[model samples]
Target: MTYLEKWFDFNRRQKEIESLLEETIAQQSEQSLTLKEFYLLYYLDLAQEKSLRQIDLPDKLHLSPSAVSRMVARLEAKKLWST
Candidate 1:
């Protein structure tokens, strides 16, 4: 009920959800995906025309612009190789 208690509860639930998501992704995907990668796809899927600018991804993914660029490059490589 207290602020500290509420914060702790929120944090605990977030961790639980992340764990469940990670487990499910591992079980379902042919190629292993990190949590951030999964989140990137999820965000794109929800975006207009299923597209988003790299500049917007850093705030959404809590990563730097360079990190987003690297991640996008890696994902693109994986897509090319998978096909």
Candidate 2:
């Protein structure tokens, strides 16, 4: 109930949730996608037309533009996603 205790509790829960999500994503996607990639696809699926500008992905996925571009390229290479 103290501030430090609350902070630690919050961190613990966050880690647990993140771990669970990673496990679920791995199982469901058959390890074909990383958590970030899964999130990218999820964001695109939620877009108005299932598309978003390359520049917009950095903010959505909290990655640098270059990182987003690289990830997109990898997905495209794998034939799993495209612009």
TM-score for each predicted model, relative to the true structure: 0.81, 0.81
30-83: candidate 1 lDDT, tens digit per residue: 978888998888888898976688789999999999998888888888892110
Name the candidate that leads on lDDT.
Answer: 2
Q: Give the TM-score of candidate 1.
A: 0.81
Backbone clash total, candidate 2:
0
Q: Write the per-residue lDDT of candidate 2 for residues 1-83, one digit (tens) a residue.
A: 89999999999999898788888887877447778888888888898978788888998889999999999998898787877
lDDT of 2: 0.86
Quality of model 1 by C-alpha lDDT:
0.85
